[model samples]
Target: MTRSVYVTGIGRGDGRQVVELGMMELLTRQVDRVGLYRPLVHDTPDRIFELLRGRYRLTQDPATYFGMGYEEAAALQAEQGQDALTARLVEGYLRVAESYDTVLVLGSDFAATNLPAELGVNARLANECGASVLPVIGGRDQNAESVVAEVRNAHHAYTNLGCDVIAMVANRVDPDQLDSAADQLRRSLDVPVYVLPDEPALSAPTVRQIVQTLGAEVLLGDDAGLARDALDFVFGGAMLPTFLPALTPGCVVVTPGDRADLIIGALAAHSAGAPPIAGVLLTLGEKPGQDILRLADRLAPGTPVVAVPTGSFLTATELFGLDGKLGAGTPRKAETALGLFETGVDTTELTERLSVARSARVTPMMFEHALLERARTNKRRIVLPEGGEERILRAAEVLLRRGVCELTLLGEEDAVRKKAGDLGIGLDDPALDIVDPHTSPLRDRFAALYAKLRAHKGVSYELAYDVVADVSYFGTLMVQEGLADGMVSGAVHSTAATIRPAFEIIKTRPGAAIVSSVFFMCLADRVLVYGDCAVNPDPDAEQLADIAIQAAGTAARFDVQPRVAMLSYSTGTSGSGADVDKVRAATELVRQRRPDLLVEGPIQYDAAVSPVVAAAKLPGSAVAGRATVLVFPDLNTGNNTYKAVQRSAGAVAVGPVLQGLRKPVNDLSRGALVQDIVNTVAITAIQAQGDLR
Candidate 1:
């Protein structure tokens, strides 16, 4: 029988769509063909379903995804009483369950329905469909004790109705209260409980959502502006200087359209990137003059501006009622929601609870999901030296929003804020720490520490003071002094600049001869660990063996079972040379040191990974052609090979994650994208967890 999972909420504003979307993300990673079923939907189009279909490429018919419209279902329930409604929804769910390997059944919202008790209705549907229930309890304005009590009550409510409650989630609590809230919930409930802090971005109304809610006329803006989230609302009634300071990043400015001075001043501030507003709301049916509108257009080309007939007070009232939703136009919000859910929930345990088995194949999405889930465990703090860089700040936002780990961005505070403002990114979260390395109080302390560490090298405190002022050195000192667990740099600096401080101050780990790097090459169907690609020009026989051992440990740390393959020119004495001899010696050393490790060597790349080639070249050799971990002899070959495969084969290379370090410090390519930084940061956090134990 096909498995079904039901995601339902107890009340309104529970934000359960995050759970539903997150569950779908996990399901798709486990099963090849997953279907979606909505027991009851509003009369409007199912926005969340549309988003899932577009994102996951579901082949199920759009019409088949839903059972009945809200009015139709409520009428049936009122006429034929509850039995008719239950039968209709169960029929829709069974169809999807029969057609796909698994089905994600979205339950009804308690509010905006005619049913007497939506909770009871949802329980009956879950029980009738033979689905596992994930009950969501809202904790937006509740205390920790109250949230825990509500969750326990939810479990009783579901279980009393004979529904199999797989887990309970306490969502939308204050960020600072999450830890205490989660602790209480875990202690109170017997089943698995996950706690997600409130995300203001999800609750904030986007420009598009606001437009639809208010029926406002769009005077100016593009699609990108429409998607910008309005985090806060600022009323424009005071003088230009006073109002300008109130205009914040991602806020909608509400003012009279005739006040071109306030309008022009806001736009100018946005142009200067002081703090970019979401859009300007023209109240009282007022519209800007053609000349002023054109100036606003040139000031910020794509910034949104809408006009409504209602006054400021009424407009604010309606705006406050509107909340953002996860859908097709809001892909970024969807990503944020998914990250929050994955970070807070223990997905491995959740799968076990549901008895869902994941596929052996490791797709890129699955690998990315694992990276996020693993980083969340230890919650290490990572410092970024190039904090003011656009890509770094964006990555920092993603990291913090996902609750993956703590972050300290090192730079000039004012400059970083202005840059982030211009990009329309919000940095108001309390967990985010921004430090100016030059002006930080820790500068003198770090300088003293650096001088002492380098005293034998004739370094004085004064000279070390200047050295510690550099962002890279300051960040590295944080890792050395235990202020941060790791550091990720090289976004704006050379690789040498990024790692020079680590080698000088942090140094290598004990029982390790050298530091090397590996890239987790994410192919179409599998993830292969490629090592020593970015560091160490060449290694002797002993050093080569050490790299293999370190690389194997790193692979296993990330849940990738290790099968070590030492690469060289020859395959089992088929050829002989200086390179082949070194590889052969290294292979022997590995066999002696780690006898349990499956080892092969002086093997060609083809024979190491291709079963057909292994059958012909080195028959019956255990480690040939099925290796999960591939250790190259030198940097030149490994670097070129990983790059070739990454580009030619369309693989995602997630690394040069440094191995054999005392503390975790990773580097990024100067040309890295936003996602590249996110992946590397997550990897660094996971590496730090290993350091802790």
Candidate 2:
């Protein structure tokens, strides 16, 4: 099954960039598909879809994705009664829900008021679609009660409408207040509550905003005079043609005199019932030739054109770069979606506190004392793949500046230096090693491993070099060959691209049979472990047992007890099938293999999750409910279910911390946002420290 999560409520000014960035974060955790659905979008089209479609290459259509099929519900509200409009909205939402695994229903701007009725509509739709409703409340203030009330109201509406309440997310909360607000909501609400921190990293510059930031004025006709913001700016003469379709209203065309024809033609096409051209800023102090001017006049008469005194288009690009206005503040809707993912909400802690429950297993140490001691005393080698990139450089700089660990970047010295120079970043430190894959002594070792793995399949040494040159494989080989303490990749690659090479070269830990993943969910009050979402699909009992053990180990590493809950569709003897049987057998195997483990299985998610539900399901079962580590039977069930809980239940999901590698190594998705990369790096660092133990 294709892994998917549905997202909605995207058409507002609260910066959907974070949503896009956040969704990219989810993608790294191995979710194959992400669907956006806005059941009742306003009459005005949301520009995010256009931006995402063009810039991010998102294939889903914005019109249909948002569920605004020609007639918008807001438009219907004026003609029909509110109830009728609500029904239409609900119908649209239901249609979207059927196509995706987890549906993220966005509340309108008037969620404080309109949500009461809208929530009912969504609840009915959720029930019909068997989807979870994650209410994402976008706000600027830290009024805990108001936020809690909004969440509760949505939950109440959904519950009253005969749907389950999953979670509530407080979007755009100030960083300082994020913890407090999350805490307040967690205490007040029965379900999980997450506060998405306001991260400026995800915001991309709008063309209008970019123009304004550069101190350029717009002069194109009426629409040009109208204030518009550019979603992003494109550079290079070669890219101008490709970027034209991505141009929205208020897009300022910045180009050189040599490309006047290109600029004029693009502007003409854009102004023809197009969104609107913010204006054109001619670079290189060159005016259009007579022929170009005549064409511009005929195509877009009176279009405002500004000329910069810069010597060349490249210089103008550099100017924008120097000002930090080059695609830096543009909002990415995907990041906003990711920020909506409920993390840092301690659902287990809350559940235990609310129900006065105790875990069957003893709590672990606050910190891994032995590991911390080892990290403090030893010089640990950390490998970062695609080290030539700006983000990785910045991360490495951070680690170096803080004296955290020794950093190694995988790249050729000259190319890395050149790229670093282009970005105006200099790394002069001797501690940082720029290892060229071709020249490194360890290259032979990696080549040998590559040959050993592929030789049986008719791959030769020469072929192995080309394949292993991919940093994912190269970096994994570094760990396998004991050249690095840990390896971190995936920023420039997919999960498969990152992990497959590792699986082939490094293989799993000696005793571990299958590789799996677990996210250490950090909430305001506590942390819960969610597993098998990042790796493994349709895991049998043995694989499930392995996941359970790994999740428990991860929980322990993070200072939490391992009260493992093997999640299934049924609770105890209530349901029977291969899926339930897998969970039950896994539970039995976990007990047999590791009697020290406290585990329960063949349990419904709620029963495995809630103490109240657990008590009701099995009166005296030892591990009936207070389980901290949730081990899913398969990727399909784990990924979709976790996202449902993350988005709808308001649980902040943190990881798919890749486990079972010989050394701690993890991957990042190619489109992962900065914060996600930062967090993954931090997690990888911590995991590296864990290996010292």
The models' CA-based lDDT, in order, is: 0.89, 0.60
Q: lDDT by residue for model 1 over 444-463, one digit each (tens)?
A: 99999999999999999999
Worst 10 residues of 2 by lDDT: 362-371
lDDT of 2 by residue, 1-693 (tens): 222222323223444344444443333222223345555555445644454444333456555556553345545656776667656666665555456433344434432323335544555545554454445565555465565566566556656777554555567677777777777776887777667766432333333444455565433333323222333344536664676666654345677766865677666654453434545667766777778766775665555555665655554565455321212223332323332342333333322322322322321111121222234344567788778876777666544533446778989877675444333233566667888877777777777778988887888888887777777788888777777877777777678887888788777877788888987665433467889887787888888898888778877876677888888888888899887888899999999988998888877778876779888997787777677788888888888877787667565455568888777887765665554555565566677765411
Tell me the number of clashing residue pairs for each predicted model.
1, 53
In model 1, pairs of residues that clash are 608-625
The TM-score that candidate 1 achieves is: 0.83
Candidate closest to the true structure, highest TM-score: 1
Question: RMSD in angstroms, all models?
Answer: 4.5, 16.0
